[model samples]
Target chain A: MLDLAILGLLFEQEMHGYEIRRRLRDELGLFANISFGSLYPALSRLERSGAVAVTESGGTSSAPLLSTGSLGGERAGLRARRSGATLGTKRSRKVYRITGQGRALFEQLLEGEEPAGADDARSFGLRLAFARHLAPSARLALLERRRAQLTRRLATDLVRASGDRLDVYTRSLVEHSTESTEHDIAWLDRLIDAERQKQAASRTDGARSADSTDPSDPHSGDAMTSSSPTGAS
Target chain B: MLDLAILGLLFEQEMHGYEIRRRLRDELGLFANISFGSLYPALSRLERSGAVAVTESGGTSSAPLLSTGSLGGERAGLRARRSGATLGTKRSRKVYRITGQGRALFEQLLEGEEPAGADDARSFGLRLAFARHLAPSARLALLERRRAQLTRRLATDLVRASGDRLDVYTRSLVEHSTESTEHDIAWLDRLIDAERQKQAASRTDGARSADSTDPSDPHSGDAMTSSSPTGAS
Candidate 1:
């Protein structure tokens, strides 16, 4: 899960270890307490596997430290320059950039089957966060897989509740759990409906374009807009 | 987390290892994939700590194997007896029962501050599952603590989404995550309200009972009903 989160972030931009940790907490809202102890080891493992390349910068270079446009990066760079450590023999900051191999690995992991014994909620959240990079079908599959998992959970909860000799609090907990799962399923249904409609509309546009001779039609522009990286309406 | 779950089960009734595993999966709906490899070690740890006591049974003993009244236990017992293993040198099944110290441990763990870096959702769910054992004030605190955690998460998610360069899918994921947190908080609010009402009603009953001279008034029965172990109104 940590690997997936790290690769997903690096897929967007090169980042040093500190920046990656910050984004994991602030931007991703998962792995909020990931420590440098685990983070450094994961980074080292990724480096050893050739999934990422590390480049040292910020020793004497006046260039900006981070590739990200966030002000936090600029401030960190300024602080480093002001400290006069740039003139010392200290090792430079190592920025990690995802290699082509890492990109392939990310895609593979994103599209892969979730392993057993994994934390299901975190696994799903991490994949959903990076679903934009997935093919449309793959994205739909991800949503459906999550829906199925929750559905099974609800079924089990109902079965357990039905014959339960459970105390009041446990009964309430089970009922609430069932309701939450149902709510999630309803939400996924909406997303699935939207995806199908978008896919159908795009297919109709493709057919119309093939039937017409116009090279610059408005419908083609609409198709491009709908299929843009954001995949938002 | 595993220890809490194990003790909670044993607090209800004594059970052998296999029965405990079954309940942990089928009843709790959490730790569904817990293997014997981990389960046995946890049981051993608990036994070593004097939290649980184990007794060997099923050797030439016709007594029901499990304290739980589930039909599954009957079948397992019948199968063991039918296979003639009950008469063999195969070690008798070990039935684990929670000790007084174990019950204390369970309560302490349930009411304790959640450790950092733990799986937050699982920790909350486990605590809520056993919340019937908590004092009313502790139960209210648990609900409020969970509410505060979700509120903070939602705030962070909204801030991240506001000035975000996130792709469409990630943006949608964040939005959905925010909505889910809101849904959870709303659920907690209802629980908190119910808890407060129950407390108030009991207090009113107490005041009335104190004012009355009759030791066996109808209101006393009402009070008893409300304070029953089931705690369901």
Candidate 2:
């Protein structure tokens, strides 16, 4: 989950560690209390795997000078190169940029089957947050997968509620859980309907435009826009 | 969280490990895929801490025979004691029952201040599942605490949504998250109102019945019932 969040942020822009943490907290509202302990290691892992490249920025400069060395090598070089510089100067910072490998990894992770566990909700949320990068069918599949999971949960909750052993409080908890699951399914239904309509409308437009353009390219302009049903408000 | 769930179940009736695991997965719907790898260790921890007592029951006998040995000692004793018996005899299963310390621990965990993190949702759900054990005041506090948390989350989400850097899909994710948070807060508000009404009704009844009962005894019948608003289906 942390890997997905980190990669998603880097997919947008090159950023230093501090900036990445800030955006994850403020803009994405994820990993709100993520520690530097975990963040730096994830960055290092991605760097080691060649999914991201790290470069060193000068103490006073905003633009990072691209460095070809590894992160450790760059850090040592920076220290040696600046040994005789003025004291009390700011230290260099490492900036990270996603590579082609990272982009492919992000897409793969986003479209992967969700592991059924406690983190299912977070996994789904992260995938939805990056859903625009997905093809139309893939996006719909994501929503449908979530709908199926919640439906299964509702069925279990109903069966539990029908049992005779539950106390008043436990029964209430199950009932409320059932209601919340129902609400989620309804929300997903709306999303799926909107997706189908968008696809249908795009297909109609594609057929009309085919007469003027190449007939071979069917999905000429199928990219999602900001006018998505949920995005409108 | 696992500890609280185990104790809550055992607080009602003595259960073997399999039954406890079953109830947690099917009834609570909280830890759907908890492995015995984690479950047995938790049970052992509870037993070690004197929160629960474990006894061995013969495979053929449904009723567990009371033994005072610790889990390990009992395991060793069982091996030695059953060695002379039939070779095909079923192995004894351990049944766990909450001790006084376990009950105290459960109450403490349920009423403790929630730790803020990704597990906050599961933590709150576990507390609510055992909420009848809490005093009426504590129950209200739980609901109010959840309300406050969701309200804060909604505020952050709205601020993020208003920013322009978000793309179509990221914006939609934020909007959907905001809607869910709003829905959760609204549900909490209804619960809080119902709780207040129940407290008020109980208070009025206490006053009316004060003549026959102890005059100083208030909160006479403030226990929550399954008639809670969300439980009405």
- What is the DockQ for all candidates, taken in turn? 0.29, 0.36
Which candidate number would show the highest TM-score if scored against the true structure? Answer: 2
Show model 2 residue runs off by greater than 4 Å. A35-37, A58-89, A207-233, B59-86, B207-233
Q: What is the C-alpha lDDT of each candidate?
A: 0.72, 0.73
- For model 2, give the TM-score of chain B: 0.77
Displacement of the residue A162 alpha carbon in candidate 2, Å: 2.5
Clashes in model 2: which pairs?
Answer: none
Encode model 2's per-residue lDDT on A1-233: one tens digit a residue: 77788898888777888887878877776565678889999999999998898876455466555544354444456566675422112366677899998876776676678877767777887787777666677788899999999898777677767886665556766777777778778978988887887778768887454221122333222433222433221
lDDT of 1 by residue, A110-210 (tens): 77877545478778888877766666666677888888888887877787779656656667767777777888889889888877776677588874533
